[model samples]
Target: MKTLRKYLSAEGLIKSIYSKFKKIQDPKNRTGKISLTDCLMSCFAIFSLKGLLQAEE
Candidate 1:
């Protein structure tokens, strides 16, 4: 249980999660100003914020 608590914390997992996001393949035909990893991370951030907001209610 103690081990689970340590790794499961959002602070601890963020870097690992972001690294995984960077590995995803980009399907865009041409490279744009923004990178695919950034886009995915942005969506992840939005979803995380939404979850936090719902938890507060």
Candidate 2:
């Protein structure tokens, strides 16, 4: 959400990156491998949420 925007200048940055990776000739994308979206979301989750959780521990 909005929190991710701090790390990414804009939403288009994420989309453009995803699109570029999608066009690669790698077999992973064609098969059952993870997509660019998953990686991006994971990173976003970590960056946005980890700091808050660590403080509670």
Candidate 3:
């Protein structure tokens, strides 16, 4: 439990969550066929992963 808490804090999980919401609120690319929300969510996840990588440094 301690290790989990440490990981979450050190990794900035809260910032990542907010970033996900921000992405959802933005517009998508020129193609409107795909769901913007879905695309944004995926992008947010990838961004969060990158953030985690940076945080680990």
Candidate 4:
């Protein structure tokens, strides 16, 4: 079974980000299909990919 232990790896960093994002309260007046955390993580993923692409150039 997989454990919930935090590690000093990339997976640990992602888990940390997700946990922190969950603490942020949603501010939208109307509810959307996606959750706030999912939106924030999507943005983060985009930026991360952009950085990687730039570094490859």
> Which residue pairs collide, candidate 3?
none
Question: Candidate 1 clashing pairs?
Answer: none
* lDDT tens digits, residue span 1-57, model 1: 245454778866777788898898887654789888888877777777777557667
lDDT of 2 by residue, 1-57 (tens): 245553457566656666665565654544457665566655654666667557657
Query: In each prediction, how many residue pairs overlap at the backbone (N, C-alpha, C within less than 3 A)?
Result: 0, 0, 0, 0
RMSD (Cα, Å) of model 4: 3.8
By TM-score, the best candidate is 4
Candidate 3: regions farther than 4 A off: 1-33, 50-57
Best by lDDT: 4
Give model 1's TM-score versus the native structure: 0.62
The residue ranges of model 1 lying beyond 4 angstroms of the native Cα positions read: 1-6, 51-57
Candidate 4: Cα lDDT at 6: 82
lDDT of predicted model 3: 0.59
Give me the displacement of residue 51 in model 3, in angstroms: 9.6
For candidate 1, the lDDT comes to 0.75
- Report the C-alpha lDDT of model 4 over 1-57, residue by residue, as the tens digit: 876548776678888999999999987744878899999888777677677557657
